[model samples]
Target: MTTSKQALPPVVSTATWQKELAALRIREKAVTRELDSVAAQRRRLPMTEMPDYVLEGEDGPVRLAEIFGEHPQLIVYNHMWHDGAEWQCPGCTGFTTQFTRLLGLEKFGARFVIVTQGPIDQALAYKRRVGNAMAWYSTANSSFGSDVGAPPDAGFAVNVFLRDGDTVYRTWHTDGRGTEQLSHLFGLIDVLPYGRQEVWQESPEGWPQAPAYSKWATSQEIAAAYGEDK
Candidate 1:
């Protein structure tokens, strides 16, 4: 498969390209600093007490606080679900699958997991279908998902929590593109010259374009792509 050279950036001398990249580095540093500042403010945001909702876990029912395991900090990705569907939310499935190894987060007292509105069996089935690596739980028996911003048949969300003994507090919540930070796939795509190729993106004329999210694969597609057993 050969890539088209048309609509690509103009060919440039190595010295000129290096000079342009050096200038871009300054802007990249500024953005990184701004992100650091934002993270600092997020750490200072006030938290609210959260109920000890019983979520369905693999072994059995588990309390919200127990979801943190030995960690005091927890990051939950509230994955979207469609009732009785074979395929779960493509965006959520794709997003969560990117985080296959999160054991390192435990060193910082953090545990990352997925909480979906689907039944435990269904959620786990999708997990196996897509070969998701993060621990997953179900909020089907409780209002945890809805109260936390992932209402049924709605959208996906990322919620941060802090646990003190058996008590848990909601520290932060974000959705939409705010969840993009956790997606290494999107981060990599954004750096590409064509940049996601989504129609909503501001790209140079004649650049490849497709509907936003058109590239995300369904659970079945992902399973086949990775040769996961169905």
Candidate 2:
């Protein structure tokens, strides 16, 4: 049996294309403004006092409060890691790749780090495998993961905290697709005609798409593709 290719969008004159683009731009601007408004509201949200959770780090056991260092804010990426899995979740790895270098975040008084439920040694090994320089810690014996809305098998999450002198507060937290904010790849793909090329996306007829998550590869798999060993 043979399969048929999907049809592409109709070709249009330059002037016609510009007209359609201009219409889309209007809605795009509206979206931008709305997003800005929502962000402003997010900034005004009241913070809740957080527990003094402890996690294992490369140096040794460290308190969540101490992770802030001299910074006034902290952003932790909760990564998914099962005990016996060969590698971490592809989506979590992809999200973390975008944060390999977070030196710029220091300028804004925020310290960024990754937290996982796996053993500290395993987490460190994976970090080294991916060539990530950012700090990583393991919440193996702590409720930090669940308290932050990232359970053992819950996948990915991004949580923000604020430090006030000797106290720490949970400022914001988001999980699931909200974690996409940490993904630069998806942001870049959104500008393309086919977007992420995921089956759930509403692409134009004839555009390419495959089942979502079907093409996701683990960090080790991705590195091996480039001749690097985990």
In terms of TM-score, the best-performing candidate is 1
Write model 2 residue lDDT over 119-183, tens digit each, in one string: 99988888777756678999988999988888897767899999998789999998878866567
lDDT of 1 by residue, 1-230 (tens): 99887698878999999999999999999999999999999989999999879999999999998999989999999999999787777788778887877878888999999999999998887788888888999999999999998999998899999999999999999999898887788789889998999899899999999998887777667777652584
Indicate the TM-score of model 2. 0.91
Candidate 2 regions exceeding 4 Å error are 1-6, 225-230
The residue pairs that clash in candidate 2, if any, are 6-206
Which ten-residue region of model 1 has the weakest summed lDDT?
A: 221-230
C-alpha root-mean-square deviation, each candidate: 2.0, 3.0
Candidate 1 CA-lDDT value:
0.89
**Model 1: which residue pairs collide?**
none
TM-score, cand. 1 vs. native: 0.94
Model 1: residues >4 Å from true position, as ranges? 1-5
